[model samples]
Target: MLAVLLVTSCTSSSASGEQGDDAKPRSTSSARPAPPRKPVALTIAPGDRAAGVEPGAPVTIAAVDGKVTQVLVVNEAGQPVAGVLSPDATTWQTTEPLGFGKTYTATATGRGTDGKDATVTSVFSTAAPRVKADLSMNPLDGQVVGVGQPLAFYFDAPVANKAAAQQAIQVHSEPAAEGAFYWYSDKEVHWRPKEYWAAGTRITINASIYGRDFGNGVYGNDSRTAVVTVGDAVVANADGATHQMTVTVNGAVVRTIPISMGKPGHETPVGTYVVMSEHTDYTMDSSTYGVPADAANGYRTTVAVASRMSNSGIFYHSAPWSVGDQGHRNVSHGCINMTTENARWLQSISNKGDVIVVQNSGGPVLESWDGLGDWQVPWDQWAAGGKK
Candidate 1:
């Protein structure tokens, strides 16, 4: 009985060994192959489901181990956002900034070297602006102005980002007026052509500031436009040494009149100027121009036929007291003094932007910022001032 049991045990052991060997071969042959790996991957910036993103933040989509095939970005209204694809077609980014408190979606597709495709979609929202600035323009719509008139903008609030603010404003002219924008102050900016505007030229300014960020949580409220038409060229040439004033219309000398300029200590400024305003009767105050009324050579008198030619209290007005000096010698406080009849006639024919060139004066040249002295700046310097 013991011998029989031993033989049976041996047979069972052999059978178990055979089964183990067979199972090992079956497991090796029937094991599932590893899942195929993806050939391309896409990544969207700001990530999917992002919130409170800055409106000026850049939005981009990039491909990995592949090239971008297509990309589309749209706002909540389904309007497509403008963007540019990379030259190699590996990435895409938005061109303009997004609006505040707005939701945007981006979808991108890419193809791998293995001929497989991959896609990704992202959604995000921009934060609302805490402060906003509004802008207004001068020259009024459809107004006819003189060649020396400047295109100016006034901001309701001070702009910290002057570069960005200037970028939002664009100026265009019919015959291509080359100009530059000069920031006179925090809230004011002015633009003037390299030279005076050609007669009958059309000027337009487009201020696309809406949705533009100006730093420190400040954004632009709305956009604006200003259009102006240039009229005939009226120029006045004054010779301080000869005490003569010549008026020209479209390059033709229309009239010449005797005039008296500044005395020795109060010589007139030489350079180009523009007529700012006209007044049938105006009071001349020495205090207004920084000269105290109690000081020597200071006078406060009311006069007829006055035309404001500068911000520093300079004018072309009647000064009958100095009639003997007219056309003979320069003797007056610092103005172009003429007969009442001639002053009235000149005032009647001149408009707000007429050019006035003062030559052969003893004083320094007029400053470019002194009441429409933009013509005093050279074209190269003016253009360089606008470089970003």
Candidate 2:
């Protein structure tokens, strides 16, 4: 019997174990898809709750394998710190300095390649210096000075790292002059050109000392700028042999004055001098320099006009008492004595930084530490920085 065709035709089951042909196969592997890529680590300098951090230390936020998206840094006073973010948003840096002895807060946010966010925060305090060095500069800002003037700086606290101090003080001049810095002491420094400054030169000094380490726990207190203008090239060359002073202006001889310089025992120093100051109706007291007014060589003389040339008691003032010896021989004590009229005329034409050269005086050379004796040292020696 066809036996009802006994056709138990066996059709294969679907790969999905379903009866329909449209059924899809199922995955048998148990492995899940690889996890999303991890984000880059974010770092902030002066880590959280840091203390005694240098104000000038790089207050920065950086990331690797990620990008910085935003940043905020503020002082305790609610003042925001100035900062700049990298163009690629990978780093943030502080542009302005932080205040000392104050707590600061910083927040930075970043995003990783996995599309994840990273946030970081820091609370830090800047170091408080044991001592702050006060800075003083000359020539005064916007003042006019003569060509021989050197830009001088004085620090109240001694600087152990003098080279760093010297680097912080920069001098810029128009028609650039070859110059160098000479340190007279731990707290004093002066900058001068190899030759006298050219008339009409403009000079600017930048003292970026704030946050600088001067060593010995000393720190700079502030930053400053000074602008000075150089005026006429007024020079006075005094000859102890000729007993005359030839005054020149801009390389032209302007006047010839009969003068009596220091006596044999107290000869004027033979070197260059820069005019320091001018006085009107001032009294010259010998006791100021330890010479008693009652002493034989000491006298309290008052003058109408006087131009102080040296710190150790020297001036070309109205010494009418020595007018009789003018143009004749050395008679005064370590000063160029001149007539009152001539002295007044000299005062009228003089300004700070003017040059006064004493030649053939037979006295010892001027000490570099004396007054403004920056020109006393040869250029080669002066350019050697100093014994710092």
Question: Which predicted model would earn the best TM-score?
Answer: 2
Misplaced by over 4 Å in model 2 are 1-52, 56-69, 84-95, 109-123
lDDT to native, each model: 0.82, 0.87
For residues 1-388, could you state the per-residue lDDT of candidate 2 as single tens digits? 1112222233436566556655445433344455556696788998998987767666899988789998889999888988998989888999998887889999999999778998999998887889999899888899999999988899999999988788788899998999999888899988999999999999999998887778888888888898899999999999999999999999999999999998988899989999999888879988877789999988788888789898988888888887888988999878888888988898888789999999988888988778998898888888987656
What TM-score against the true fold does each predicted structure earn?
0.67, 0.80
CA lDDT for candidate 1: 0.82
The C-alpha stretches of model 1 lying farther than 4 A from their native spots are 1-131, 156-160, 185-187, 386-388
Give the per-residue Cα lDDT of candidate 2 at 106: 92
What does the lDDT come to for candidate 2?
0.87
Alpha carbon deviation, residue 245, candidate 1 (Å): 1.1
Query: Which residue pairs show backbone clashes in model 2?
Result: none
